[model samples]
Structures are given as structure tokens and as C-alpha cells.
Target chain A: MDHKEFIRGGTALSEDEIKSGKIFVEEDALDCRYAWDTGVAIGRYLAELKKGKIIAKKTNCCDRIMIPPRMFCELCYRPSGAWTYVQDTGVVNTFSISNIYYDASRVPSGEPNPMPAVIEIDGASKGMGIMHLLGEVKPEDVKIGMKVKAVWKPESERTGSITDIEYFKPY
Target chain B: MRKVAVVGAGMTKFARRALETPKELSYQASKAALDSAGMKLKDIDCVAHGSAPDAFDGIHQKGEYLADGCGGWNKPTMRVFVGGATGVHAIAHGWYHVASGLADTCLVVCEEKMSSAMPHAQAFFLTIFDAITERALGLNLIWIFALEMKRYMERYGYTKEDMALSAMKNKNQGLKHPASQFYGGNELTVEDILNSEVMASPVSRLDVSPVSDGAAAIVLASERTARRLTDKPVWIEGVGWCLDTAYWATRDLYYPRYTEIAARKAYKMAGIREPHKEINIAEPYDPFGYKQLHHMEGLLLSPKGKTVELLRDGHFDMDGNLPMCPSGGLLGVGNPIAAAGTLKLCELFWQLRGEAGERQVPGNPRLGVAQAWGDLMQVSSVVVMGINNA
Candidate 1:
């Protein structure tokens, strides 16, 4: 409610009478930095990804293999039971080919237009999937239930992270 | 009226961003609460969901969106909103559902994802101002809180070090909390806080709680269901709330009149006269350092203008007579808005049940109080809790 904090500041940049022979514009880079925790389920999943394998948690009660694993199973209010490996190969549940970046900048024709997709991995419960980028395929070619496999970095380059899997492409 | 008691509590590790979707966060916290109560979604007769400022999550009608995650699928569900007070208010909302014989059990869930807001969550706070008179002012929470801190300091002659102590105490207490999602392990000193970069005069960067994305939930049940659920139940002894005028400019910045009124109503329902002597612990919403002292006075836990003296004497520490923010409160645990507010009540539940683990205070503390303030410094929500009082 106090207007004094806003009004008592330096001169506005657009003033015709420039102060100190400079037009100093205020820079309010309001973007904030965030470090998100993956928790135990995703934490272990990422570790498995570093080893060139996909992992999921087996729910104790519902007996479903959950993707992007977590500590507790939402279905039955029970802690997840087992860490089971899943096939790198998956079937595309859905997809979208984006020709622009998040900020609406055009994706240059020289570079690959990112094809983001929901890929339902084999061995996971039906329709249990992850959203990832699809590569090595054309926009018109990618269709529902199209089989795809993860493209991984060399073992030496693996850093125990999600990016270990470069992208998914039709095998 | 049927008696209601909290039988279980749970929370996710707070962080700058949860990385998981808001629904997933709600699911985790809700699952934990239900698991702690040895129950399932089917056992919950209703749900009370709370979130503050849709701008934080960037989703409208988030309550309905989160209903299934909160175990409210096809069940009676209510969404509560009142800015920062949504946490305590939602719990009270659930309490009434059980207290009014409308439900045998209610699951209260609160979540916030401030990191989803672009630029910064503070940007959304700017929109909460009075449009015609205040929107063009470009003010943020820090600016307003700084003004209030200045008023309190000038009135009581309190120094920065005096305010800094609250931050110091809470941060140290946070080390024991695994869910203290924002802060890394650091035992802070008052001098470290006072010397930190000043956001506004008397309000340093360390004075404020970090923006966080997380969720918390608690399970409430009627006396019959409560007895069958757990050996120990924390009774909801009292619940009260009040909203003052949004014309914060006209109100005195030195005190929160609404919180006092809210506390009085809660105290009367709980049948308490001497809150300072009766209540063993308190969590009074410390999103800022001085606010701990400011709200301590407002909650009537500390004499007006003398909170600094008690703070200086280590009266609000873990081993002190009355441990405030023993769950590290919001300043240390990270404030995910509604989730953090609900976490305060969850802290009281855990403490009263002797289940606080590393953060447990001595003396087998029984009675406790939690208060949340929000919305242009106008709204206050208060809840009094106890054990063996049912």
C-alpha cells in the first residue's frame, strides 16, 4: 500500500532529460531458479536409466507397474514394493510435432523440429507411460501405437540423469 | 455436535519445484496420510482440498482437478481458498464436515506449486492488490512485509538482530526435518541473517521463506472412527477464523487485529483462558522473520511488544518452555503457500502424538495452537489442538 517505495526510485529511462548522460533502463529479471527433487521412485528410475535400462515400481496392493516411480502407491495407500526393469522399447500413445519453442520462437528448419510424445513402455501397465521427445522420425510418419526405442548416450558419458536417454525413435 | 480428532498426518518434501505435477504431489501426501491412519481412499467419507492463488499453479478450478488425487473421487468434496489462510481454513472445513455429522471421516489436503508461475510467484502477488488504486504501484510481498516490519520495529524499538533470531532458531530446527525442501543443511547464526543482502530495509533475503512446491494432508475422523483408527488421536479442540477489511493502508501495521479475534474465538471454544501457559507449542506462520514475533503477539502467546525479549531469552526454541515452529515452520521448511500452512497443523498433530521423530520437543507437550494469516493482511485462521482432551 505504500507508494513511497515505488516513487522514490531513480528517474525513468524514457525521460527526455537524461540523467548522467545515460539512458539507464531498469532490469528486472524476475526469473527464479529451482532445484526439484525426484524423490525415491524417480531417483532410482534415473539411476537405472544411467545403466541403459528403464525401471518402474511394482505396487504392493494394486499389482501394477507404475512409471516415473514414487515412494507410495496412490491406488492403495501402500509403499511401493519392488523396482522392476522395463523394456526400452515402447509404443507411442500420442504425439505432437512442435515447430516452435516454448516462448513461440520458430524452430529453425535447419534443426529437427521436436516431436514430443507419450510413449507407453512395454512391461509397464497398459497406458502407463512417460512424455518424452521422439526422434529419427517424420511428423506425418509418427502414429498411435508406433513402436519406439530409447536412444542412449555412450556409457562413459552417462551421468545418472534422464538425459541419458537422448530420445526415443522408431526401432 | 460430534467430536472430531485428527488421526493421521503427512507431507511431501518441499522444494523450489516439485518436478511432479500438482496432482501427483497431492496424491503422495494424501496416500501418506491415509497410510498413517491405516486406511484407504474408500474409508474417507469426504475430502477438503485447499490451494491459494490459482496463478501459482496456473490452473483454474484446481480443487476439482485435484479431487481424485485427494481420494475424493465421486465423494463429497469441498475446496477452500483464502490466500495464505487456506491451510488452516481447509482443515476447519473438513472438521465441520465431521463435526456436523455429515461425514464420519474427512481427508484435508493442501497443495501449492508457486514455481509454476513464470518470472516469479511474486508476480502473481502483485495482481492481488486493489486494481484501480494499487495495481499500478508495482508492489510485492517483500515491500509490504518490510513496511509492516518497519512499523513493528519502530514501535517496539526492536533491532534487526532481534528479528534475525527467529530465522536463526527456525533454520537450525529445520536440520532435523527431512522434508525441509528448500534449505540445504546449514546451522545459521543471527549475525549471518542480519548481514545478508537486504531486500528492503530491516528485511533481509534470509528473513523470507523461499518459494516452494509441495503438498501436505491430514486425516480427520469422528470420535467413534478415531478410537478405531489409532491409539492416539489429536482432538480438534477449537477452530476459528476472521477476515478484516482489505484496506490495509488504513489499518495499523503494528498489530494483526484479526488474528487476535480469531484466537479469542478459538480459545473460547477450546475452553482456554491462559494460552501462553496452557499451550505447550505454537506454529504462528513465519513466512518472514519479524512475522514470527508479530504473530506471536497476535496469537496472544506473547505479550505485546515483549516478544523480542522472550525470543532473546530462547523462550521459543526447541528446549525452551514453549517451542514455536518446531516443525521448522514455513521460514525453514519452505513455504508452498497452502501446503506450508497445512504443514503447521500437521506438525502439531505429529508432536502431540509423540511421532515428530527428530523434531520432537521434550516435556511430552500436549496442547498446541497454529495460526495462518493472509490476503492483504486481513484474514486469520486459528486452530487449537490437544491430546487426552476428548
Candidate 2:
């Protein structure tokens, strides 16, 4: 058992100073972990991305195409989905300010961070927004309908993961 | 269909950390509710349980694991989940058990042990996303709320300070609740909220509920059984629930239409013509401060993009024309996901019975509505309750 710090009479402390009290100490905490069974599919996708290729999937229902392939379309409920590729360019549809750094644990942790904008990729239609860090322009410099391009990592560092392309900046 | 009434409501001490096992926590609340209703386990014909996520408890098939504690043993029991909306959904499920004549009495329990999980509850939320698309992007749960809040602010011309008032108002109201954590009138200012830790852009730490460990249970009985038990039984007058598309990427995030649809159905069934003028009080799910305003608009208690103005005008306070979250809401009372919703139900029970005491609204409130939203914010469940409707 541990007793949290409570100041006595040494000096005055700001509320901000008192707020940082929980920054460090922790104990035997239980956490949940997930291991995907479909590792082979992920592995193959990474390999393709490393070769500098983009991927998509075609839903059998309306025959509409989707990126980052999937097995089923919850919307159409049709089975037997397959992979398709697309040209590697999309546009920013809508955006917003994210000044706080958050996750479940740390959000309640009472900390703070800079805000990032909600960016819609170029090729994606309206309402298909993905969260990625923004760079190359200030928050004031960013605007809706701004033309931005993905800043991909060096060829050798390309992986099938989202990190392959870093933050999107002014085109 | 038969009429249904809530005969009893019980809850564990709402806290930031509860050391008991989920089973133990479930037992504590379930037993209290049963005892309060002067009923035994044998009196329950069916059981309904709700837990927000197995990740919160670190157990899969959470319903089965917690079944025995909720008295589901060898009976017609089922677990219902709708993200954060599970608590109210459980109540709705229990209402059906008696309304459909499937059971004479139903035990509804909601429990969450967020403290049991480590690293952060934020990590578990990472999995709520699409593994390929959103998950790969390393999204936090608040990212959605922050983005939604930003959109709501933009659409309605609401300022960050306007949203902060919810935190101040709700937390202050919480001071009156015996089970509230941050009670004692520790007032909060908009500057205080803005200066507090930022969780996501435009969403501050103070603007959100704490990760809590608690449980709440309510007993729903058929009209006959309820009359036999007590004359002051709180009747479940109307119930409605809806789920929106799980694809968060495909819909307009500025407003939650699911909540509006659910509220409309409940209000209609309850014969409420104008919710704000008819209903005496409300408990809109407030896991996030801005959510209270967002859902206020969806519930039609206030006009679209006008809840912030209502809040600013002090129209939603305890002494306001229509008091809201008089139970402290999830923000001040602490949010254990499912249990938070049920606690709102309990608050309504007390309010309608004129037994809310110090935390109770000043007038004799005859009717109140409680709402909960969950599942990537795609589901809404509402329950309208009254003291004499039975």
C-alpha cells in the first residue's frame, strides 16, 4: 500500500503543480491483449506495401471498391470479398482541431497535448475521414478543401502499415 | 402486453477504484436491489446483465462469467451490450421480460471494473476501431468525441467555454449526491476546465468522466407483482432503443441521430407532447461534457445547436425549469460505463418517488427520462418513468 503526497506547510503550490502528482507511480495492473489470427493476410499486405503498391477491396454487393481490404461488408452483407488496388492519391475532405493527446488510460490521467486536425484523405469520399498527425502548416494555415499529399517514408522503410506514410502536409 | 414497474434499485459505492472482483461487485448491487424490493433470488424469473466491454473487466464472455453473481444461474438470462448504452439497454431488456409475460420479475444489473485493466483503458479503445483502417492509424476514443465536439461547435457557433459550463454545472450538482466522488461543491470554472489536462483536441480531462469501478442493479416487476410489493413503484411508462451504423467513418458526426430517434419513440409512447415542458427532469448520458449538450439536442429537449445556450442561460440546473443530471451525471458521479446508465435510472426512481432528498429537485417531479448512448456513439436507449403510471 502507498500513501499519496499531501503538502503540509512548506510552501504554496499551484493547482497545476498539484495536478502532476500522478505522473509516475504504478502497480500490478491487468491489461487485455489481442492477437489476430489472420496474420498471413496482414503479412502479405505489408509485403505489397513495401514494394510501394496501394491496395483496395471490391465488395460484391454494389461492386463498390474499398481500401485496406476486408472480408465482409456489414452494409451489403454479401460474402466472398476480394482484393483490388488503387492509385495512391486522395484529397482532404473535412478537418478539425485536436489539441489534446489522448488514449483511454491517459485521458483520465489528466494530461494535455497539442490538437491535430481530422483529415479526410483525397481519394476517399466525404464522411470517410481518417485521423493522422498534420505537419508543414500551422493550424491557422490549414483549411477545409486544402490540397494535401501523403509524406511516405524512405523506400527501404516502407511497410504495409499506416506509418509507411507519415503526417500529411500541404501538397 | 403487461405493464412493468421498477420495484427496487441498488448500487455499490461509486468510486475510482474498487478492489472487489466483478462477481463480488455484481453480487453487492444485485443483492441490495433484491433486498430493497423485499424479494429473493427465487422470486426473479429472468435476468438481464450488461457490461460495457470484456476488456474493462479483462474477461471474455463477461456475461457468462458474471452470470452467477447477477443470479442468472440456470435461468433465462442474457447479456446485452451497446457500447456505453448497455445499462439502459439492460433496463429495456428487463422491461420486455415482464411486458411480454416471459417473466414475472426480472433482475437487471450493470457492472464495470475499469480499474482492473492496466496500462490504460485507452489502449483497449484502440481495438474498437477497424484493425486495418482506423486502428492502423492509432486512434484514441476521445479522438472521435473531440472531432465530434469540434464539429458541433462549428455548426452551432458554440465556444470551448460554453462547453466547459457543463463540466462546472454537472460537477457542482454532483456535490449533492451521496455516492458522488467529486462532491463537496468543489466548483469548476471554464478557465479551470480549459486549463485542466487535454485528452483530445477541444476535449479536456475535466470534461470527461473518470474511469470508475462500480455496479448498479434494478428490479423490474410485472404490474400485479409490483402492486403487491409497493404502492410507490416507479413505472416504466415508455421505452425505446436504436442502433446507428457501426461504421463511424460513414456518417455525419456532428449530431447523434440514434439518440433523437430513441427519444422520439419513448416520448411518443409516454404520451409526452413536449418533452421540455412535460418532463420534469432528465438524465442524458454524459460520459463526455459536450455529449450532454449533443444528446440534449438529440433528445429534442432543446433545439439543434442550442443546448449550450440553454446551459449558459442556466435552464438545465437543479432549480431550472427543467433540471438535468441532478444525479451528478457520469461526469460528476463517475462513469463505470454500464453502471453509470443504471444509476441514472435509480436517480429517476428517487426523483419520481419524492425520495431523492437533498439531491432531489425542489418540486414533486411526476415523470423523468433517462438516456444512454454507446457503440462508437451509434446506439441510443431511453426509458421514461413515472411514480403513478402503473
Candidate 3:
């Protein structure tokens, strides 16, 4: 049996077809809002970040210190033992130098390429990291295992969010 | 457990922009699948629908909206989701419906109208990130793949040229696929890919699959129902799906442990210890050029850091030792997320039954595997299928 005979062509709508209302189109925006609870662990972690400090949740079951602190241990499934302050310094786990914007449009010429990295925080277990932007260095200079420090906003400008640390830079 | 087989499969031509609404696309594929099975909507006992986020379609509760089109007016219906894994997972759900003795016949449908999210389909992709932590950093979906591609290349010592082979081969194969969105039937060289404009570093425009609007469907039935319906039934030998933690940052990006676990589960159920020797053809998801290699490693089809070598040696070519992506895959066929993954299963169904016309691999291919990876590099869904020679 010819599979081609079973497959059907999709209806392609041209701009004129839509404009002439030959093809009906609905116009609306998704205006959904979400106010997610930060929960105990992340809430406290955010509070510490607002004070210009990086904190992690420590688990007694194992010596693992989890960044972006969680209330429960993922491996042991037990409540985290305590909150430990980790250094703002970290090593880049992996990085990307993107010339495209979020919507996939090309970034304008002469603008700095956005460099994002998964930086494994110092004093945390191996590979315990968070996603953030990189700054204060050329895109070419960013390397895996490159030591970096958080570039925090001014104390007055700090918000209780991950943006509290503006970005990470070469320490 | 009872046996389940795929009696029929269908897919619409993938396009960048489709005039049909999400429901219409679902109806087209579902009706074609039913027609291929020589069955009617009234004959189906249940409907299993799979789609990605409702944000892309701009319709909330998209499953409920797509129900009637998929022949779920009064039948037992369910929607399965696991990011991009939803398509294969939906088929797994249909298999369960038949194998569990709850239903004798089931219809599995997957649809994605990425063009509906105007300006760009990627805008909806941004919401998949962590709300409190990752989103504020101004990260986009491409960044994660770029980072992983960089890591995979660095760890394996593979080059962009090595990855481009997949892009070139898949696109060349797409020439034969009628449902492919980018099927210009043109040949592309590695230089063509290397010279393509860079979207993310190490990931050029050619490295990624195009966002597409499409739908695909398959009809599944129990042993008795399948025997009655068709002489050439493709059996669903095994199914597996696994997900890693949402804390994607902490894990190593070079290899997909979740895909390994999922493949292992499926292989165990299929009673196959060695996938490389046992599985004849493989359709590992290839949204990006390197991802085919990444998932091949995860599927244990190739050893760690060995896929590129095999690829360069023509091991994974359509006529090579182990043919990969004989249906052109997402890179050539177009990627409508959930729908694209389901399309892989359709290819396997066609290939196992020797029904795949121009894209059919040489040799009487008896067994094949289709796998999908999604959700921030977390989930993996796999299905092993074979012809019912008995």
C-alpha cells in the first residue's frame, strides 16, 4: 500500500486568506498570572540572598549541600538538617554564548552576546549549580571550570529574588 | 500481560503554518488512522490524546477541546503529558488500555500547532523554566541545548562537522518523506551547515529542527482485535518512560541518565539485553543535530563517546550497519513537539511492517525502537516494536 495515498496535505493559510476572512482566526492573549509560593527553603534562601549572602540546604543523611535550597532531600527524602552559607564564588559547569534573543530573533549587531552558565557553587557538593548570566568577560574568555564570583546589585537595589545577584563574573 | 499491536497509523504533512486549528489537525490524522485500520470511530473503545503545553495552542485544557475531533465524544478518553515525551507516552497509555483488558481497541492522537503562538513559538517554551530561579536570569530554551551541545562535544571530543553529518543525512532522507515540512529534496553539505548563521554558540540555524504545525495518530488493539483487523500488525513489545529531577542545573548535561533508565526498562521488558545487536533500526529524537548522538548513547545503542566515530564511519547511515532515523526524523520531517514524537512511532510501525515506501531501510527489519526526550533535558520515553511473525 502506498503510504502517500493515506497522508493528506495540510491547509496552508496565506496572509490574504486570513485578511479576507476566508479562514477564521481568533485573536487573544494568554493573560494567566501565577504567584507561586517560594516555600520555606527557597524563601529563606531568598532572604539570605537579599542580605548579600548565598545559602544552601544541608542534609544530615549525606554530606550533600544543595543550592537553590530545598526543604527536603531529593536522595534521602528527609527534611534538610540546616542552612549553610556558601561562598558567592563558583566554577562554570557549562556555558553558552547566544546571539539570539528569547523569541529566537537575532540580537542586534555590536551588542554583547548573552553568556549564560551553570555555575557550580563553591562549598556545595560537586556539580551542585544554578543557572545564571555571565558578565565582565568576553564571550570567548568564558570557559568550563573558570572561577567566577557573583556580581551583586547594590544593597539598596537588591530584591528578594535570584536577580539579587545581578550576574556572575570572573572573580 | 496481554499483547497489544498497532493496527494502523497516520500523519498530516508537517508545515510551518497550518490553516487548520488544533482540533482539525487532530481530526485529520485520527480519521486517516481509522481509515487505514479499516475501522470506524464507533469501533474504538477509548481515545488517548497527547499534546504539549496548552500555551502553544493558545487554548487552555487543550485535551478537552481536542476530544471530539479525536473521536472521544462518548468514549473513555484521557490526555497524557510529559513535555515532548507526551506523544510516545500517549501510545504507551493506549497500550495499557488494551493490555490491561480494559479496552480492546484504542486510538492515540498527538497534535501541536506551534504557529498559533504568534510572534514566535519559542515564547511559550520559556515558561518551562523554573519560575523563582532560572526565569529571571533571562535564559531561553536554546541556551540549555547550546550548553549541552558544548559539553557533549567537549567531553566526547566531537566536532561540529561530526554533528552536521546527522543534519545532512536526515535532510537528504527527508527528500523521500512526503510528510516532511522541509522536504525540498536537496542535498546539503557539511560546509553548508558550518556556514549557516549561528543562533546559539556551537549551535547554528541548521543545527536545530524547525518549529512545525502537525498531527499524528495510531490505532492500537489487543491480540484478538489486532488479528481480526489486519494481517500486518506491528506489536508493541515494550514501553518505558523515566524523568530526572527538575533541578536540571545540578546534573551533568553530557549524558542523559533518564534516557538510559527508560531504555533499560523497555529493553528488559522486551527481553533484549543488547540493544546494539538486537535492535535493527533506531529513531532517537533529533530536535538538534547532536541530540541524535546524545540519545543514541542514552539508549545504549552506542557506547559512551563512540557515536560520532560510528557516525563518521557510516555506521548509522540508512544503508549502514545500524540505520538511524530512516524516516528523516525531526530535523528533516519538522518538529511539532508532541506530534513529531508520535510520528517516529508511525515510522517504526511502517518500517516494521515493510510498508514504508521510499524511506524503508533495506533488509527485512524486524525490530525497531523509537525514543523521545523532553522537559528541560529530564524525561525520556521509549517504545520497542516488532512485526508479529507468529
Q: Which candidate wins on DockQ?
A: 3
Candidate 1 residue-wise lDDT, B1-390, digit = tens: 889999888778887755567788888888888878889999999999999997676566888787877788899898999998989999989999999999999999998877667657776787787543344334566656765776688678888888898787887787667687533486888889988865545567788888888888999999999999888989999999999866454456679989999999999999999999999999998899899889899899999999989988989888998899998888888888898889898889888877787788898998999999888778999999999834
Q: Where does model 3 sit among the CAPRI classes?
A: medium
Report lDDT per candidate.
0.80, 0.77, 0.89
Give the per-residue lDDT of model 3 (tens digit) for B28-88.
9999899999999999999999999988877789989999988898999999888788888
lDDT of 2 by residue, B254-292 (tens): 888999899999998889989989888999999888898
Report the Cα lDDT for residue B211, model 1: 81
Report the Cα lDDT for residue A89, model 2: 50
List, in order, the clash count of every candidate structure. 1, 15, 0
Question: Per-residue lDDT tens digits of candidate 1, residues A2-99?
Answer: 11111111111222433354543333334445465656666788788889999988898988887767677765888988888889999875555554
Better of 1 and 3 by lDDT: 3
Candidate topping TM-score: 3
Q: Candidate order by DockQ, highest to lowest? A: 3, 2, 1
Q: Rank the candidates by TM-score, best first.
A: 3, 2, 1
Give residue B368's lDDT in candidate 1 (0 to 100): 95
As a whole number from 0 to 100, the lDDT of residue B104 in candidate 1 is 99
**RMSD of candidates 1 onward, in order:** 24.0, 6.6, 1.4
lDDT of 1 at B237: 95
Complex DockQ per candidate: 0.01, 0.19, 0.77
